[model samples]
Target: MSTDKEDLVVDDDFPITEEDVEPRIEPAKTNLSKRRTIDNLLEERRLQRQLADFDYDL
Candidate 1:
């Protein structure tokens, strides 16, 4: 069952069925490439910082 709300409009000829009135999950991954690039950059910076800190600690 869908948790989405639908508008209650009075239609005398409206047909109701399980498949007819159901919302489906869209198989979409929006902005994944951009997100991955940002994540990789952040991870690389973290590794570089860690290496620098290790050299200073020694």
Candidate 2:
């Protein structure tokens, strides 16, 4: 068992290209918008539940 650095072997079959490394902006924006919408809906629902549970006699 040799611990030399030259013993490492890399496979050339799978190479990283520019398209694979580039960031996709449009999909990310849509996903973020959808996530925000869901978050807003959840917050609204939670607030409504709290309002329904409030003690009006106080």
Among all candidates shown, the one with the greatest TM-score: 2
Backbone clashes in model 2, listed as residue pairs: none
TM-score of each: 0.43, 0.55
Per-residue lDDT of model 1, residues 1-58, tens digit only: 9899998888799778888866865545646766888999999999999887785644
Flag regions of model 1 displaced more than 4 Å.
1-30, 55-58
Across 30-50, the per-residue lDDT of candidate 2 in tens digits comes to 999999999999999999999
Per-candidate Cα lDDT values, in order, are 0.81, 0.90
Residue 11 miss distance in model 2 (angstroms): 24
The 10-residue segment of model 2 with minimum total lDDT is 2-11
- Candidate 1 TM-score versus the reference: 0.43
